[model samples]
Every structure is written in C-alpha cells, then in structure tokens.
Target: MASFEINGGKRLQGELVPQGAKNEALQVLCAVLMTPEKVTISNLPDIIDVNKLINLLQAMGVKIEKVERGTFIFQAKDIDLDYLQTEDFKNRASSLRGSIMIVGPLLARYGKGFMPKPGGDKIGRRRLDTHFEGFAKLGAKFNFDQQAYFYSVTAEKLKGTYIHLDEASVTGTANVLMAAVLAEGKTTIYNAACEPYLQQLCKMLNKMGAKISGISSNMLTIEGVSELGGCFHRVLPDMIEIGSFIGLAAMTQSEITIKDVSYENLGIIPQTFQRLGIDMELRGDDLFIPSQESYQVDTFIDGSILTIADAPWPGFTPDLLSIVLVTATQAMGSVLIHQKMFESRLFFVDKLIDMGAQIILCDPHRATVIGLDRKHSLKGIQMTSPDIRAGVSLLIAALSAEGKSVIHNIEQIDRGYQDIDLRLNNLGADIRRM
Candidate 1:
C-alpha cells in the first residue's frame, strides 16, 4: 500500500550500478537444487520475489546461508520431503512463479515433484504447458488435482528425449533444461530460449558437470549425467534495469552513467534505443548518456513511422517495452509500440494519456504514441502502478512531468527492482517513498 511521491521536472545525474539479473537469479537459485554440495552464488538481486523464493527454499529444508549482501550459499542435501505436502509450502509456492522451477530439480534428483499453481504478474495468461509437456516427453507421469489446483509429476528415472517446445518460454526452458541434466542418455531441445540468463544457466550447469552445448542458439544439446556437483556462479547485470535507466535519462533529459553493464551480453538493446533517438556511448564497462533538451525518433529507411515490438531473444525484450513506451511520449516523433507476449501490459497507456501524453491504444497489445516533441511537458497526475514494469514506467514519467505525481500500489515495483526509489533518489531524482 506504499506510494511514491515524486516532484517532477528534475534531471537525474550520477553513476548508478545495475542490480544483478532478477530472472537469472530465479533460474540459478533453482538450479542450485540440482546439487547436494556447497554452491555459492554472488550478485543476487535482493528483491522481494527473490527473497520469497529463498524463504521457500529454506522452508523446504534446503540449507541456505546468507554469507553477505547479495550473496548466498546453498546445499540441498537435506531437503524435507514431508514439507512439500504441507499447507504452508503450498501457500508460499502459489505466491511465487519461481517456485515452478523447483519441480524440475526435485523430479530429477528424487524422482518426484509437486507444486500449487504458480503466481506472478497478471499481465496475461502465462501457462505451464511447456514445462509439463517437456517432462512428459522424458517419461514422467503428469497429473493435476483440479479441486486443489495442484500439479504433480513423477518418474522412476527420466529418460532423455528430443523435445520441440511450442514456445521458447524462458522459465519453461530453464525448468526443462534442469530436469534433463540428470536424466539418462541425451536430450535435444529445439526452439529453446537463448537469452543471457539462459546462457548463464547453461554455463553454471556445465560447471556443475552437466554436458550442454549450443550456448547462444535456439537449439540445445544436453548429455545427461548421473549427478551434479556444486559450483560458484555470478549473475550478469540486469539489462532490464539498464534499459529503464536509459529511458529515465532520456525522458528527464539527465546525464547518467550505468557502470559495469557487461556490454557483451546486451546484444541489441542499445541499438534498439538508438532508434528512439537516444544518444549512448559505451565506455569500457560503463554506458554514458548525456542530457538533451529534445530527441527525435528515427524513421524507417522508407520514410515510414517506426514500430517497436518485442520478439523472442536478441530482439526487444517485452520486459522493457513499458520503459520504451513511456520514453516515446517525450520524443519528437511517432512510434508504434507492440507488446506481443502479454495482452494486458499495454493497458497502462491510459495512465500516461491521463498525464497529457497523446497516445492511442489500438488494442490490448498495441499503442501508438504521438510524441509532444517537448512543445509542452507532461502534467503530473495520480495513478496506481499496474505491475513491475509499468510501475517504473510511471516513475519515469513522473520525473519528467511538470507538477507532482503520486504512484500507489508500489509493492509490484518492489517485487522486481531493488530499492528503485532510493536508487533513483541517489541520482538526484526528486522521489519520496510515502
């Protein structure tokens, strides 16, 4: 029920460090359950979602030590099987989508896994078909209790097989991959997600003695081993956070530097922002963005209005589309933002429209933004954040608006971004948490 009270029209300036990948932390944390030895993970995002998953793991009898800030050591040798059937475990598991990942490692190691319906942002329908379908292909028996809304999968011993996923769902890929790592024989997965988070997951699994190839491609080959050992793995910087910062700088006309971004992994994000007329320079490990009074959107080579849309990987990520959409409201041109994965994500455009930004919501998934070109700045308004990504988008708009803006229901924002209000305040943003 907390709110962000922001005085707008303030430019942010400073070097802000990006937090560790939230998506990667979820996948890596679950992958730790594949081994019984000590596994140390560093640069873990201290966000609400991650902490909830960690607490769930601790409740399940996994030995976890908070070695230091943003670091944890995990040993899953003493998992309590009885706890998995408890009401507390079910309630906690239903609260986190990351809990679905535990099904894979548990099934692989102990031949059984059960979970309640996983919950997360209600942007759209996020189905668990890919995870269960992949498991069934590997000889697991899948059953669902409609009355309890519970799902369970069991196997005597998994036998690897080829699987062609219906979609390259990120969490689905991670879950299936974890299950296949300890199964017998070889497993080939076509159309698997190859995002940086998945790349890190594969590398970590390999370090733990799993045979996996095709690191950056949609096709992955895994040779199942009998067991896995512990390994130390560090998550890459959050690209979503970097994108949000760049959008914030552009909309507020601020000079900001994002440090240690691991540029090699941010494949096409920078160039995508460039299309929105953002000027960014990658200096070693830092991305420097200078203040600008006005930035114009780029047209296509054919002189047509540019369209920004989300795709699988190496394409514009759907996670950052909200930032891009909000940033477009201040640019000097018109751009169509299409969010393909989630239907309801684009509904937040109504809030921006209320703030005096000219926008057209074409459908549940498309928004056409007519930039003000800085002819007049947006007027601050009161709004409630719909989700994690939309919350930050509103915050960005509030920083660039004329008056003051109040954002309620910020718990959604806290689920992903790590202390975002404090971090932005450090960079001179006039934001107060109330």
Candidate 2:
C-alpha cells in the first residue's frame, strides 16, 4: 500500500552503486536445492523477490542463515517437499515466476516436486509448456490437475539426451540445465536462453563440478555428473537496474556514476541507448552519465524514423524496453518502441500519456513516443503500477515530472529494484517512500 512521492525536475548528480542482479539471484537461490551441502552466496540483492524466495526455501526446510545484509549461507539439507502442497507455499510460490524453477531441482534432488501456478509480470502468456516439455525429454513424467502441476521422474538414473526447447524460454532452459547437471549421461540443449542470468547459472553449476560449455551461447552441452558439490559464488550486478539507472539519469538530466559494473557483460545496452542520443563514458568498470539538456532520437540509416525493439540475449532485453520507451519521451526526436515478448507491457503507456508525454499506444505490443526535448516537462499525477518494469518506468517519469506524483502498488517495484528510493535519494533525487 506504500507510494512514492517525488518532487521532480531536479538534476540527479552523484554516484550510485548497483545492486546484485535480481534475475540471477533467483536462479542461484533455486540452485541451492541441487545440493544438500552448504552453499554460500555473496552480493545477493536484498529485494522483495529474493526475500520471498529465501522465505519459501526456508519454509521447505532449507537452512538459510544470513551471513550479512547482502550475503547468505544456505543448505537445503532437509527439504520438505510436502510444503509445496500447503496454501502458504502455494500463495507465495504463485506470487513470482521464479518459483517455477524449483520444480526441476526438487525433482532431480528429491525425485518428486509439486507447485501451484507461478506468478510474475502479467505482460503476456508466459507458458510453462517449454519447461514441462524440457523435463519430459529428460525422463520426467508430469500431471496437471486441480490447478496444480505435479512432476515426478521414476528413472533411478536420469539419462540425458538432446533437448530442442519449444521456445528459447529463459526459465525453461534453466530448469533443463538444473535437471541435466546430475543426469547419468550428457545433455545437449539447443536454442537455449543465454542471457546473463543463465550464463551466471551455468558458471555457478560448473563451479560445483557440473561440466557445462557454451556459457553465453544458445547451444549448451552439459555433461551430467554423479552429484553437485557445494561452492561459493557471488551474484552478478543487476544489469536491469543498471539499465534502469541509465534511463533515469537520461530522463532527469542527471550526472551519475554507476559503480562496480561489469562492462564486458553489458552486450548491447550502450549501443541500444546510443540510439536515443545518450552517451556514457566507461571508467574502468564503472559507467558515468553526465547531465544533458536534451537527448536526440536517431533516425534509421535510410532517414526513416528509428525503431527500438527487444529480443533474446545478444539483442535488447525485453525487460528494459519499458525503460527505453520512458526515456524516449524526454528525448528530442520520435521513435517506435516494440516489445515483442509481452502483450500488455505497452498498455501502461496510457499512464505516461496522461503525464503529458506524447505517446501513441499503437497496440498492446507497440508504442510511438514523441519526445518533449525538455521544452515540456511531465506534470505529476497519481498512477498505479502495472508490473515490475512498468512500475519502475512510472518512477522515472515521476522523478522527471514538474510536480509531485504518487505511484501506488510499490510492491511491484519492490519485487525487482532493491532499496530503489534510498538508492536514488543518494543520487540527490527528491523521492520519499510513503
């Protein structure tokens, strides 16, 4: 029920440290179920989703000990699979999409798993067909009844085979990877999702004695081993947060520095933002965005209006499409924003339009934004958050608006960004969490 009150039109000038990646942390936490030995994770983001996952793991009898604020030591020594059948587990598990990932690890380790429908950003039909399909290929049997998904694999020794995913679904690939790590034979996954999150998952699994190649590529070859041992790994910095900060700095004309960013991992982020005429200087592992009067939206090489779209990894992330769309509203030129991954994501543009942004929501998947070029600033208004990315988009818009803006459903934002209000406040943004 909390809201953010932002006094906008102020230049944010300071250094901001990015937190650990939320998406990566979710997978890493689920990976703990792969082993009964203690696994220590450092640099974990203290976000709501991570906390929820940790609580869920603990409820399942995983020994979760906080080593520090952003570090934790976990051991799923005595997993209670029966917990998945309770209403508490169902309610919490259904609140986040990452909960679906537990199915594979639980089945691999415990030989059985059950979970109710998982929940996440209601942008599109996030199907579990890919996940179920991948598991079936790995000698797993599944049943769906009474609004719950039940999966079991009777094969004492799981033998791996080639798996061509129906789609390059991120969680689907991850589930298959988790299951294949301990199978009897080798597993080859083609058309896999090689996003940074998945890459980190592969790295962590390899560290634990699972043989995996093609870390950042679509085709992954996993040589299933007898068992995985415990290992310590640090979660990667939140790239989505880094992208969000970039958009925030651009929209507010802020001079900000993002610290401890892995520059090499940022594949197409810089180039994607460059299309909006926003440039940043790379200082070692940090990114410095200086305050600017206005940004220009570049046109296509043929002098046509530019279009920014999202794709799988090596392409622009769909998660950041909302950020790019919101940032474009403050730029000088016009551009088309295409969100191919989700249908309802662009529907939130109506909120931006109400804030004086010249946006045409062409459909559920596309929007055309004409930048105000600092000649006009968005006036503050009360709005509701639709999802995690869209909620952060509203926060950026609120931060750049001329007056106070109230954004409800702060839980949506909390699910992703960690201490967002506090972090932005450090950069001199006049925002209060109410």
Candidate 3:
C-alpha cells in the first residue's frame, strides 16, 4: 500500500495535457473483440486497469502490436476459448469491473460467454442487473451461479429487440451495443447512455461497418450487421481528468493551461465549474485557468441556497462531484453537492472535516460544504482513499492545504489517472510516492 506525501500550498503552473479517457478506453478496447481485423486505437492512457485488460486480451490469444507509445494495433483473429475457461482467466477477469464488458463481444462472436463476479471501487452497490437484463432482452439467455459467483450468457443467434434500460447505465449500454452490432435485424436502445464514451463507441462501431443512429441522444438505433471491419479510433480527452484539472487549478490557486482538451466533447463540465465562481478562459483547444485569490459559491436566482448535482449526459457528470465537493470547501459560501448515482461516495467528507473543513454529510448521497473562504488553510492529516474519484479529490484537498498530508491506498488513484504524481510534479506540485 503505497502513500502520497504532499507538501501543500505549492501552486502548479505551466501547461499540462490531460490523458485519454479511461472510461472510453475501457469500452473501445472491448470492441476490438467484436472484429478480427487489425484495429488501431490511439490516445491510450497508461493506467493499471487498462493495462490489465490488455494483458487479459493477450492471454485470450488476441494478437496485439504496439504502434507507438499511446497507440496499439489489435487483431483478434484467433482466440483461445480453452484459455478463457481456465481459473486463471476467471481470477483476472473478476478483478476489474470493465472486464465485464468482455461478455458482450464474446457472446456475439462465440455462442457463449462467462465470468466470475466483477470487482471495482466499493463506493456503492454497483449492480450488473442492467447488463444482464439488456443482454436477455436482446434474445440472449442469462445465467448466474450464486455459489460460484459467476455469470454466463448464451444465444444461438441474437435477434435485435427493443431494450429500455431501467437506468441509464453507461457500461450496460456499451455492452449491449457491442452485442447488437453483430446481431440480426434492428435493435433499439431507449434511455441509452449517450455520453461521449458511448458516442465514441457508437461512432467507432459505425466506422467498422456497424449501423448506429442517434449519436448523442437518449435513444439509439442499431442495424445489425453480420460482421465488422477494423478502423482507426482516437479517443477523446478524458473529461473527468479535464474537470479534475479545473478543480485543481481553483483549489490550489494556480495558473494552468490544459492542452488539447477537445473542448467540444466536454459538454457541461466547463460550465459546471463556472457555476462555482471559478473563471477559466478557452484558448483554441486548450483551457486556461488563472490564479485566483478567492472564489464564491453562487446562490440561486431567488436568493435561495445553491445546489450542485449530477445527472446523465448533457448534464454534469457524477464522476466530478467529489472534486466539486472538495473544491467547494475553500469557496466563499455554501453549496450542496448531490451525488445521486453512488450512495457511499459522499462519506469521505468526514476525512475532509477532520482536516478542518466545514462539511455536513447529509445521508449517503448529499453533503453540504461551508467554504473556508481562504481565511484559514486546511490542516493536513492522514487519510485513506475510499475510491478513485474520492482519492483524487483528497489529493486535490491535500495539495491546497497548509501542511503535509499523507494519503494511503494510492493504488486506487493509479487505477484511473496515468502517472498522476509524476505529471503533477512536472507542473510544480509537491507529491511524492512512498
């Protein structure tokens, strides 16, 4: 369990480039299994989860070649089904939640797919019922062995059908999209997740000869094709990382230029930060945040209190709520941060309160943060990272504090961000891994 020892109050400067989208990379990489031709994907982030998935793909006999540092050429011409059935395969597959995406491609190409229970951040109860239900609606039979903690799906021939997901589950939509691309006839996914990640998936599939309409809407129409071809795909910049950098700049009172941000793809992120009274300038494809002495939280037009909440695509993403919450601790007023998606995500505010921030954790989903208004800097303290987003939020808080702070379980942070400490250090942050 490595930790991050940080000397707070170091204002990061200069230009920084955000890494490729981690969530998008997970979905797009799984799509490689849908086609046998050489699929070239660029802007791949060097993170633990993505790397582990690449290794799992290689173990399953997918031929992989490095095109460059952030690019890869994958050809899944031959897959070792026997190898996939081994205990070693099950153990590795169960280690990451993104690995569950393999089921869609595997079931589409082969007749069956199986895996043990998937693992990821224990922030809340993330159920796979959406994935299973979507698969079953697409004419696939679903099975789960409670004793073995395994799930399997099978279909002799998948027939397109109408699927209205119970919730707009991101990975669920991607999994079904992967399966539906190669099915027969038309498949309609109502209430689909139209995030940039899913949109990129749909676009990449279309480039590979899959027919998908409604690129950025709640309803998606897919015309099933017998096969798909390989195509080149460059993932969009990680919106979550971009949002984090915006929060980092405001929290630490720093000036930063985030290069090549793909501003068009970041729908509501920039505006969300603006709501926090943070000023940012858009310079071509980059985002420039000037150093700020103080920022205030805006109340509603009726002079009511302010609320920052998360929603689906075209709405503020839930992933950045933790960053928003932690950053609000230093603002000039109060704000209610509502994390509707995950229940336990807000529990980490207790650690922030211990560090001298005024935070009221209202149940499992909401937290009220009273800003310190830059009057008194936070006192550093030892803390445990709860999950990926919370871990990064804590890192941001630590960087903005007065003294030294130590954060344990930094592996959680590594799972999402690529070389975070090294990259932040280059920008003048004091973060040491020990």
- For model 3 the TM-score comes to 0.99
TM-score of each model, paired residue for residue: 0.99, 0.98, 0.99
Top lDDT hit = 1
Q: How much is 208 displaced in model 3, in angstroms?
A: 0.8
Model 1 lDDT tens row, 318-384: 9999999999999999999999999999998899999999999999989999999888799999999
lDDT string, candidate 3, 290-325, tens digits: 999999889999988899999988889999999999
Which prediction has more favorable TM-score, 1 or 2? Answer: 1
Candidate 3, residue 386: lDDT: 85
| Candidate achieving higher TM-score, 2 or 3 | 3
Q: How many pairs of residues in model 1 come into backbone collision?
A: 0
User: 309-423 in candidate 2: lDDT tens per residue?
Assistant: 9998989999999999999998999999998988888999889999999999888888999998988889999999999999999999999999999999989999999889988
Q: Which runs of model 1 end up more than 4 angstroms from their true locations?
A: none
Worst 10 contiguous positions by lDDT, candidate 3: 79-88
Query: Total clashing residue pairs per candidate?
Result: 0, 0, 0
